[model samples]
Target: MQAQARGRKARRWIIFGTIAFGAVFLVVGLVLAGQSVSLLNDAERARGTVVGLEWRKDHSSSSRRNRSDDRPAAYPVVEFTPAEGTPTRFRSSTGANPPSYEVGERVEVLYHADSPEDAQINGFASLWLLPLVFGGLGLLTSGIATVVALVTRRRSRPRRSLRTTGP
Candidate 1:
């Protein structure tokens, strides 16, 4: 009986640990996915100008961060009249970098034609990271929740059979 109790306690700890860890990952993934969604919404409302291209030093593609960091990636920020527009800049991970476009280069951005402000550079809307991140997260959360539920149900079943013979 004591061993049984100990076993149950151990199982409970395992479940608790699994739930906590899974929840943390789920939250992070959801946050990333949510941000991507928000970016899309903002892009739809964009009419900003090519304020300038910022070479962000921190953007990296290195397998492991080392003495030599990944070269800065180029991103553009365009300013719109009246208020700043949202859709601005471009990103790519191809081995070759996009040509350096200058501040005054005349370029047209594609956006929600319904609302000019809601827009994006035509070629850039297909970023894969957002979808992959969300899909993997949804799968992980579902699996963990399913396992925890099954363990809980199995543990609650009574060991004795519900039958009686009366003399």
Candidate 2:
């Protein structure tokens, strides 16, 4: 019975963890998707040159193992100045190896005319891609977990007929 209780507790924790992760992913995905739409809607958009690439390596625990044999990777930060005279920059890696876009390399940028601060270097246009991928994974995990929980609960319930007195 103790073992069964432990098992049930573990299962409950798994479900809770799965739900928390799914919720966070869904929220992030929605926010990112909304930003992408806002970017697409603004009529005042312009193309800009890469100008320069900001390079940096992430030395976090996750990246430490990945760089065991390879040289440190460089991330790119695309810098651009819109016709509106506002300066903008987007780090290609978000936080990974800075893209190797050399200084003065040309890369397009999308910006909002009214608020040039709301700009992104097309170099990382895959911004939307990230949210979608994570959101999908979360939803998939949530669904699988819900199904498993339901099936487990169903199979665990005992079905009996008191009318059977032969024993």
For model 2, the stretches where C-alpha displacement exceeds 4 angstroms are 2-6, 62-66, 69-74, 77-81, 86-106, 114-118, 123-125, 160-167
lDDT of 2 by residue, 1-42 (tens): 999989998998998788788878877778887877766676
lDDT, candidate 1, residue 55? Answer: 68
Which numbered prediction scores highest in TM-score against the true structure? Answer: 2
My TM-score estimates for the predictions, one after another, are 0.45, 0.69
TM-score of 1: 0.45
* Candidate 1: segments with Cα more than 4 A from true spot: 44-131, 134-138, 160-167
What digit string (tens of lDDT, one per residue) describes model 1 on residues 89-166? Answer: 443221213544556654445444445544444333333354556556655865776687687877688778878889
Query: Roughly what TM-score does model 2 have, to 2 decimal places?
Result: 0.69
